[model samples]
Each structure stands twice: as structure tokens, then as C-alpha cells.
Target chain A: MSSTLIALAAVCAANPFRVAACAPTSTDIRRQAVAVATALSVAAVGLLAVLSEAILDWLNVSGSSSRIAAGAAVLVVGTRDLFIQPPSPEPALQGWRAGIVPMGFPVILTPALAILAISAGSERGAGTAVGMIGAAILVVAVIAVGNIRGTYWRTATVGSAGVVFGTLLLLNGVTAI
Target chain B: MSPVSTRVVRGVLAWILVLGVVALVVHPEGCGQPSSGEVNEAAVATVAWFGANINDDGTFVYRYDRAENRPLGGYNDVRHAGVLLSLYQAESAGIEGAAEIADRGLAYVDERLLNTPIGLVFGRGASARSGSVGLLVAALDERRWATGADDRDPLLLALGRTLTGVVNADGSVGASINTATGSTSGRSPFFTGEVLWALARLHLTFPDENFDEPALRVYRYLIEDRDRVESPWPPVSDHWGAYALETMSRWPNADDLQLEPDLELDGPATRQWLARQLGLFGLQVRYESQRQGGITRLTRGTVALPAGVGTLGEGIGNYLRFLDRFEVTDIDVDALNERTNCVAHLLTNRQVSAAQAQQYAEPLRVQGAWFRNDITQMDDQQHALSALLLLEDWMPQ
Candidate 1:
């Protein structure tokens, strides 16, 4: 498979806010924030997909190299996710602003994820958009599981999923060369 | 939020290093790199192929479609000179029998020279293109440089005159001379670069001759006018341009020659752009490596013709030689070397081996030849030989 789905899956798998379900914020607010983040991500990634051709022309790189770079972006996040603790974004920020900041910007829709979307989207077109939607669904499901199943689920995911998928992400990127 | 321990990071890094080392050992060509020894051997085999294929009368098996098991009918006059030039390069590389093989090829070219009003050209056809004349000059220059043989000096000078006729006063290049009319017509940027290289080499051999001014003007045309007047976007892949640029680097006070009263040459910019073109050639090599049959071909694209692919080697190889010979410090030498090495590695890896050639209907036809879509032309070896010989020193051990 192309690096698109792999990168998307890796991004979801390494989502820092998988444990955000355990936060004291109300479930409606949390879901609303996630939905807003997803919308913003879709809009930005869509733009990147369209502009990818022009961007590549400007940079004097190819679609293949960009995809390779997309894979490398995953590796960068993979290292961060494997080692560093997920940022504890305070609840002092309310509404969709949380989605714009900690959730959209860092947790769900990350730099690596954006790169993957742009490259994969440019290369495979609808295939990447479909993968992005699939990843968003998976990320939401992980959080839902954490909310329903409580701290035990959150602890298990935080302890294992990031390390496992983060390693996979690194492998995915390494395979690019 | 705690970061992973330094000890853990160190342990992980150690494992990665171990895995990487093992991977490299298991499949050394993983990065598309080959040692110098293999490339040198391949170069010998290619020259041997040339030696084996030459007819008693000096004609080569110009184009062979292996699947058809027959020699395809067509001959390129420029390629005749080209093959001779490669043989000279091979001889310089110390490959045995290369000079002898080149002597036969040179005889064929000598017999084909047709005199025109301006000077003698290589063909008796309706038109004798400047490119063929230019290549003829280059081939002669290579022979002289390799063996110090000046017996054919008259023929070389005559061809140099023909090429000079194609170079206009303003440095722009004409396409060809009408053999009957004795008139020059058309414009070709590529033909101009070929002439430019010929003039540069001619100047080196006969420094007292006025070949330098023509060469400088052509160089100026390439830098300033070729793009505007002749070809547009998706510029030609120019091994000749690379050769000309590199040869210019060796000229006495090359910087002084780089200037004109009305137009100042941007030497660094031209080198960078030409270097970028070489990188484009390297890109083709990389993409070609990625291509495979079945579903992979659909994704990665079809294999490039071996002649076309061989030019990738020629482009980067000449550029590398340019970099090393002149030691021009403007471009990133390390990166250029790496790109050159990678192309050498991939080309060497992809070349037909003896054992593999045994499976073909005619071993000689298939042996030591690079084919794409089962078709191998004379130039597949010609360009590859030039590239391989020039690339020998730069290759990683």
C-alpha cells in the first residue's frame, strides 16, 4: 500500500488525546471539540491537496519525494510519541478553541498528519481523503472506548498503543528510503 | 509528563544501528550503490561487446531487437562518431583492445565525410547536420587526447570548420547545412551545445586556432539565448552541455572567457541549473529502479529505453568528471558525487550479466548490452561506456 494509509493509521494510533476521554470535560463538549478539529483538518488538508502540485513545482521536488518526506514526517512524530508524554492541555480553554489548539493542532491533526494528507492526497487523490476520514473515525472510536471503559482503558491505550503504533510509524517512514 | 529515559533511547538506538548494519550486509545494493570494481568490469564488458559486434567492413549492429532476433535497419552518423569516442574513453580507462576497436570505427567515419562549401561534414545525405560534425570533432579530439595520434589532424580540422559554420556570429547555432545548396538553416539548442563541446575540445587540441571565440559564443548562447529562441519548458537532457561546461573549466583563465562586452555570463547560475538537470537525470534513475512488471509498473511507469537511460549515466557522469577535473567548488561536491555514485550503482546493477545473457537466442547480441522493451541500440553502449569510463574514479569502493 502507499504511505498514505500507513501514515494516517500511524497518526491515529499515536494520537496524544486518546486519553482525553478521561478528562473531566463533559462528553458533548469533548465530541464537539473533536468535530470542529476534524472540520478544520479536512479544510486544511483539502487545500494542501489542491496546492500540492504548485508547491512541488515551486520546491523542485517530485510526488515520490514528497511522499517520502510525508513518511519522514511520521517518523518525527513517532519519536515524539514514543518518548515524550502527551501534552496535558488544560481545560482553562473552552469550546472549539480547544480543538483549534491542543486537539486540532497537536493531538488529532498534527504536522505529520497534514504532510501525509497532502502527499497522499496529491498522489492518490480520493484515496487519501478516504484514508483521512477513516483515521478520524478510528481516533474518535479510541476516545469513545476510553470514555465508556474509564481509566483502565485509557491507561492501557496510553501505556501500549502509542509505543506500538509509534514504532510502526517509524518503520513506515524508514521503509520509504 | 515524563520523557523516555536516556538509557532506553540509547538501547533503542543501539538496536537500530545493529539492524541497519545487518541489512546493509544482507543486501549491499539496498541504497542503489555499487563498488568501483563492478563498474570497471562492466565497462570492460561493454567495450568488449563493441569489439565483438563491429563488422569486417566497420559497420556496427546498430540497433538489435532481441525478441525479433534481427538487426533493425537504421544508422545514426553521430552515433558512429559517438561509439568511436566511447572507445577512446574506454582506452583512456585502460581497457585492452579499446584503441584497436576505435580505429575501425574511426575508419568508417572517415569514409563517410562529404565536403561542403564551408567545410567537410560526416554524411553524404541531403543534409549534413552540425551535430554529426560536432560529434566527429569530439571523437577525433578524444582519440588524440587518449593516444596522442595526430595522423587524422586534417580530417579533424575540416570537421571543426563545418561545425564552426553552424555557429552564427551572435553565438546562436544553426541546425544543419544543406549538402546540395551549401546553405545553413534551422535552429537547434541541442545541436548548438554539441557544437559548443566540439569547439571547446578543438581549442584544447589546437590552442593557436580561433576555435575559442566560437566556443565562448556558443557557451554564451546556451546561457542566455537557447531557452528564449529555440526550445521552451521541459528542456533537453544535455550530456553535451555538461561536457562543454566541464571542458570550459579546464580552459586557461576560464573566468575571463565567461564574459562578453554586451552580455555577462552567469557561470555559477548556469552550473547550478545544469547541475539540477543532472539531478533530474539521477531522478530518472531512481524512478526507473522503482519500476517493475505487473501492478508496480502501473504505479511507477514503464522502463525507460536503455538509450535514454544510458544518457542519465552520461549526464551525471560528465557532470561528476567536470566537478572532479576542474575542482569547481561552487556546487555541493558531496551531494553531486552521491548522485553520480547512485546512477553508476543502479546502471551497473541493471546491466546484463554473462550468465543471464546465456539464456538469450544469440549470446553475443544480448551479452553486455542494456535493453529496454527487448530493444538495444548502438547508443545504449555508446553513452553507457562514456559514463562508465568517466565515472570509474569517482565511484565508491
Candidate 2:
């Protein structure tokens, strides 16, 4: 099982992109966006798995080396999360749809997530479990950010989880090398 | 010039001077070079030591702590067969006492030989492993070629035949076998390679038509389904694969072997591929050297383990064989040779001295063995000895 995949999944689940895109929406609109975003996230995981070998061959890199690089990227994201404060929510942009453009196209289905998905796909059981967990986290984060009793505690929890994921990827990368 | 500009120039000059001094100190002339006769002398000493150190029942004393100078572990057939292969190679090269040492190693393997309905196998009960049998077959072939003896001809051929079962119809080889049930246990890239080499050698040594198809099957499996079978994917410079390819390329009427187009490296292609893989190891050492102080010593107070170094040596040595045998021209053989020389020098430096010999109660002393602080394993000597033997053949005397 790849720690890198789980770490990347954690990163994707806690990403600012989704929060930034959906933060301005109404309660009903946000719920619809989360559902659409979750579907995109799961689809991206499957697509990455199918195309991983071809992508690696095109890049002329081995799976192990790619995992190491992905692990490094995850570490960078985690470190950034640890030090920086979260951005304040903005009013919804004119002509912006909730799911298809920002949330589905780029926020949930990112290039970094694509790389992690492919690498993780090699480990079948682990990848499935993590991908499901990642989708669940996205849904929960969307619903809980405003409605939850302690939003500060939610932010702290996300930050702590990010640190743990980063550390695991970093250690696994070192061991693989 | 202004005072600031003058100071900047002085600072630039100072930095260059410091960098130059560091470079010179880090890589001195002949720093990792072994003496001309050093490797051969060590090889001979190693061959002699193994002969003297084997127990009467034929298994070797497995591990040694050079600092304590004492034997430290239980014996096993896999390492025992590896020692046999080294001894056979040394003897084939006319190294004195190598034949006698090889004979002792052969005795150890012979004791473990099993006669199955399919063919001759090595090891007993659940401990019987196909990889061990493959190594024995290789050793016997070398012994026969060196001495021109055919007394064990039938047994040798049969042992080679037994390996057919080790490989599945799909070409994946079970590394170990339960001789009692004739069932395979575990699959690995390493075992697949060892059996491939043995099968190829069996055909080359005897020119039997029967061995060809089996050899081809293993080769196909290795090249095609490597990712599926390789435990750790992106298989690194697998030396056994290098050896197997070299053997197949050099076989009589090699073009007639009817290899798959994708698998067909011909002579030059196989040679270049092996050399390229070996070159990566040199690159690894260079990367390590820039980050760590030297190749011989690992950082954090740990010395380089000879087994690891020797494994690299063996890979380099085999790569050299391809260069020599195929008369390969495209690759930079000299640079690769230097990489091997660096490893040899490290192994030679790490060998225990005569003055240090008395500390160990063992009669053989710690001679011809490489150590990491205190401990050395048998494969360390077997591989290091083989690498030195290759170096002797490689260098112009």
C-alpha cells in the first residue's frame, strides 16, 4: 500500500480550491456543488488508474520515482497549510455555476491529484479505500464548514490531518529511495 | 574601481579558491584505485579460505564477525551453491587450489541433491528451492567445462531438466519448491533470472535440443510479464538478467534460436542494454559521492556493506564480460571499468589484515573477506571474489 496515495487523497480532500469555489454559494447551491464535485473526484481517480501506465511511459519515469515526487509535492502542500491562514470567503462571482466549472473541472480533479491517483491505482485495495474516504471528506467539509458547532476545531483537525499525511508520504518516499 | 566593486571581486575570487580546494580534497588522485595485483591475490586467498573453512559435512560456516574474528551463523544451501559457482569459475580460470575448493563446494551441493520423477533437484523436504538447484546446475556445468569430466553428466543434465517445473506455463517462476509435493512457493525477478541463466547454460554446455524451448519460455516470461512478477517494479540493473541475455546471445547459431522480435537484442543490443543498466549503478555511486563524503563509506558512522558493494561489483564484472565477449564498441567500457575498480578498491581496503587475524579463533583468519565494522557474510566473499577474477581478466597486464 502506498502512503503517498493516501497523503495525496488527504490533500485533495482538504484542498482550498473547493472551499474557495463553493464558499460564496447558498446552502442549497453548496449541497448540489458538493454532490457534483464528489462525483468528479471519484471519476478522476478511476481515469487516472486507467491512464497511469501510459502517462508514466510518456513521461519516461518509473512508478516508484513518480511516487517519490508526488510525496514531495504533498509535503509542500502540507507545510503550506501548517503556516498559512485560510482565505476569507468571497461573494459568488457573476455567471459562475456551482459544479461543472470551478469545483468539478479543476478544484476536485487537479493535476496533482491525477498523479497521485495513477500511482495509487497500482495498489488496488488501498487506492479504493482512500479514494472513497477522500470523496466522503469533500462532502463533509462542504457541509460542516458553516453548520458545524466549532469551525475553528474543524480547521485545526484538517491542519493536523494534513501534517500527518505529509509526514507519512515523506517517510515512505525516503524508505523507497 | 569603486570600493564595493573591489570587495565583490575579492569575494568571488575567495569562493572559487575554496571550491577548488574542496574538489581536490574530495577526489584525490588514485583515491579509490586498488593495486594491480591486489584483486587477484584476494581472489586466490578467498578461494583457499573457503576450501579450508568448510565443515566436514560440506556446508560452509555462514557468517563471520571480523572484529571478533569468529563464525556467527547457521548454514544454508542457497549461499552454499553461490560459493560453489564462484569456486567453479575460479578453477576454470586455472587459479591454484580452486578445483579442490570447488570439489568441496560440490560435495555440499551433492549431499543436498534430490532425484524427482521429472529430473535432478537440490535441497530436501520443504527447504528444497529451485533457485538453489539452478545455481548447482550452473556450478556443475562450469566444473565439467573446466575439467572435461563427464562422470556427473547425466545428473547435470537431469538437474537442468528439473528446472522446467519451476517456471509456470506463463513463464513466471516460483523461486522455491517443495520437493516432497513438487509445489512452488513465491515468485521473484531474481529466481526467474537464475533459472533462465541455468537453462541457457545447460543448452550451451551440452547442445541438447530439449533445453532450448524451456530457456525460450523463461526468457519470454521475464521480458514480457516483468511488471507482474517483479516484487518491486521498475526492476533495476538485474545482473542475473544480464547474464542470461549474454548467454543466449553467445549460444552457437544464436540467430537460429528464433527469439521473439521484441526480445531479440541480437548480440550488440543485449550488450548495450546490459552496459546501460550497469552504468546507472555508477551514476548512483556518483550521486552518493556528491552527497556523502566517499563511495566506500556511508554517512552516519556506517561503513559500506561488502555484500552490497560486491553485488555491484558482480554486476559490473558481468557487464565487462559482455564488452569483452561481444567486442562491443558503442558503450564507454573504460568509464564502467573505473566504476568497478572503485568498488574493488573499497572491498580490498575493507579486507581484514593478518595482524587482525589472531583475534578470531577460526584458523582461516579474516583474510579475503570484506566487513562493515565487524560482520561479513559468505556471499560477500563469493561475489567479491568473482568480481576480482573478472577484473583480472579485464585489465591489460
Candidate 3:
């Protein structure tokens, strides 16, 4: 179960949220989708590697303390995923601009993901985190290109990932004790 | 197995694995409990730090910044006497060279000890404070007890007598005095505890019936009257009073020490006072232990100063000793153990090795000294060394 959760969370974390946000209408904009996701993933992981420590220091929060807070947030998100039903699809985003719209901002680079990036980077160090994020993005790009999941399976996979991430977060926080 | 059952089992197993890994990593075997040998090593190292750091004149080095390798100047008489007292404790604990180190300190004190109309006192003129005199007297009393040499040092005995002279009829010791002129420095908050502790030891060592009336007077004022609460001195938790209570509890005639039937000496009342001090100055630490695996926070408090924390340890230790001798059952031993362990761990962690100190100026390279936040001071080493040495007994066997 732990192994399965780790795999699923990786996939879910790497999933190009733009693909879901753009949906049926923006499927033809494949080049833009791949380009934007790859670029954003690189930039996000890079920023996390470089700035998280300084930011946390500026906030007067120890790395260990922030790790605890991050774990709690991840736990809440994971618990939510386990219980909540996915909402029905929103209206399909129209035109090439959809790559940058709700998909790029909220779906792809969420607050949780941003937090996860910083904490993971802190725990794993910059080089490992960058590789992990890059690999996650590559896997996400392949999945987005394949566009091969039914809604139920996608939801289940994402939810399973949440469980794994939340458990990991909880574990990280507990170790800090 | 059914699919759900299999999945649940796997999940539980994974969680257990993570938890186990965390526990193993964060708290390896023998993490909290230092071996008796390690305590000795650390104690020896601390004594070595003291030995390496004292000036030729016998005054301990006041402060040194390890990173910059610089000496920071400042000194306090009470802390100097406190360090002297701790050295005697170290010698009794069988730390090598502690007696020599203490002798050097005594020599320094000898220079400061002056003949006054009242009695033998430390420091010059207006600067000679009762607390310093009390600590020096107490150190002398401890040394006398350990050696069991009946021929007393006249200066030490005189200091004891002089300390008794300062205890007012109501039990408060005057804060400071012009040893030359007998001028008063007025009453201070902490003097009662210092004076009480010294007088209690004075009585303990000499068995002087004359010392009892004044000792009891101070005890009544400190315990029954709660004089600090009424006086301008803030009602701060007094570790000195706690020490005195512990001393009075073990005196040969323990029952006779208590003047009033209802006056609490070293029981719940003493615990309450010590607990308050442990609460105020104690630090609550939350740190990551990789072995625990999950996001966890442990809020455990331990007293954290060199002087106050060390004094508190002795105070609480005496309380614990009192409880065990009387076979008192109501007190919480677990809480005492936790506090003991926390302080022990803290003292160990804060210790600055001689090798570590060698990075500083030639004079500052006194290994085995303890410091906090890169700043080392004489009192810091004195208190922590005393606390750690006392911990040999307070910690579980």
C-alpha cells in the first residue's frame, strides 16, 4: 500500500493540471500544453531550491517547524481527498490561452504543491528535489499526452496519491518530535 | 485475504515501518542516558575546562567568545563564590585536580577575605555582599564535611559566624554591607535563601546550638512569612530557599528544624516552589528526530540557565532525597525524572570542549567548559558542571 501510494502520488503530483483545466476544447493545443508544464515545473522546483531556506529564515520559522506545518497541511489535503467526491467538469476552457489560465495558475502550481516543493527541497536538498520534480514533470507530460484515463480511475488514482502524500507528511512531522 | 483486508494490512505495516525507522534513528540506544563513564568523562572535561581557564590570580576566566577566540571581561563575586562551591562538589565527586582548582579559588578568596568588625567577609568595603559571603561559607562547610577534618579553618568559621550576625531578628539577611564600616546595602530578594543555606550548613557542620535560633528565624521568615511576597523584592521563585529546605530536612534533628507544626519544609511545598522555577526558566524544546518519521512536536520543559538551572537541580535533588528518605509516596517521581533527564541532557549539550575552545585565544582554550550560543562565562561553566555532577545521583541507576 505504501509503495502504491508513493507511485500514485508521484503520478498525481506530476499530472499536468492544465490538461484537466483545458479539457476537451484545448486538446489540440498539445505543443503549448507540454511546453508550459515543463517550463513551469522547472521554474517552480528551481525557485523552491534557491529561496525556501531564506524565506523560512525571514519568517523566523525553523526548517523543522515549517516541516511540521507542511506535514499538517499535507495531512489535511490527503484526508480531504480520501473523503471528498470530485466535482463535475467545469465548462471547457476555449482557445490556446487556456494553457496559462486556470490550468497554469491553480491546477498546476497550487499552494499545496508550492509548499510541498519547498519542504521536499529542504528535506531532500536542491539537487535531488530538482531531479524529482523534473522526473515528476516528465511522467506528467507523458500521461497528459496519453490522455488515457476514464474519470473514475483518474479520481481514484489522485485520491490514492493524496493518502500517500498525507501519510508521508504526517510521518515527517512525527519524526521531528 | 479479502482485497480491503489485504490493503489495510499493507497500509498498517507501512506505517509501522516508518514509525520504527523514525524511532530507531531519532533515539538510538543510550541516547538519553549517559553511561557512568561518560558522565565521569564529561565531568572531568568540565573540571579540565575550569583548570585550563582560571587566571593566575585564581579568579576563573569570566567570558570568552569561542568563534572569535576572544576574551570578554566581566566578573561577579556571588558567581565566583558559586564556582568555588561547585569545585568543592567536584572534588567530593572524585574529579581529579578539583581540590587543587578549588584551592586556587580559595586563595583568590583569601585575598578578598577581609577582617571586619562583624566577621570575615569577601570583597572590599561597600561591595562585600551577603550572598557571596554565604556561598564562600557554604563551600567551606562542604569541604569541611568531605574531608572530616575537625580542625576548622578560622576564616571559614568566622565567615559562618559573620553570616549569622547579618540575619535580622525577622530572618532577612541584609543584602550587602561595608565590611569595613558596617554600613548596610539594604535588603535584597535573593539574600534570604543564600543566608539560610549557609547558616543551615553552618549548623549542620558545627552542631552549634547558638546557630539554631538564627537559622530558625530565617527559615520562618523565608517559608512561613513568605517575606519576599510582602517586601519590595519580587516574589521570584527562590532556589536558595529550596536548597535550605532540603538541607534542613536532612539535618540530624530534622523535626527540631521545623519551628511550627504546620510549616512545610521539604515536601509538596518545596516541590511547588521548585516546580514554579522549573516552569519559568525551563525551555520547552521541539526538535525533529528522524527516527520518529512523522511530523511530531514534543513540548518538554527543562530549566536552562547555568546558575539558576544548576541551583534548581540541587534544590530539586535535595527535595527528591528528602522524599525518598521519608518514604513519601504522593510526589510524582516521573516528573522529577523527566526534569532531571532534561537538565542532564541540556548540560551535556551545552558543554564546550577544550579542543573546541582551543580555537579561541590562548587563554580561552580551556576545554570542558560549557557555554551557550557561543558565549562562555565562568558562572555558566560553574553551574552546569555542578548540575551535571549532581545528576550522577539524581539520574536513575
Q: What is the per-residue lDDT of model 2 for residues A77-120, given as tens digits with 9 covering 90 to 100?
A: 44444554543332222232435344544334444455456656
lDDT against the true structure, per candidate, is 0.67, 0.61, 0.60
- List model 2 lDDT by residue over B247-319, tens digit each: 7777886756676554565444454455456655564433222233364244322544566666666777776
- What total of clashing residue pairs does each candidate reach? 0, 0, 20
Error of 2 at B19 (Å): 7.4
DockQ of each: 0.04, 0.01, 0.02
The regions of model 3 sitting more than 4 angstroms off are A1-177, B1-31, B149-152, B227-235, B264-305, B354-366
Off by over 4 Å in 2: A1-177, B1-31, B116-118, B227-234, B267-276, B284-301, B325-330, B355-363
lDDT by residue for model 1 (A1-177), tens: 245455444444335354363232667776776666666766776777667767655553444455455545554455455455544535324665666555554455555555556555655664565466446545654564345432434434443544454345434333222
Candidate 2 TM-score to native? 0.62
Kindly list the interface RMSD, in angstroms, of each predicted candidate in the order they appear. 11.6, 16.1, 13.6
Best by TM-score: 1
TM-score-best of 1 and 2: 1
Task: Return the TM-score for each candidate structure.
Answer: 0.68, 0.62, 0.59
lDDT over C-alpha atoms for residue A161 of model 3: 64
| DockQ of candidate model 3 | 0.02
Over B329-394, each residue of candidate 3 has an lDDT whose tens digit, in order, gives 544354356555655655565566555655666534556765555667888777667767767775
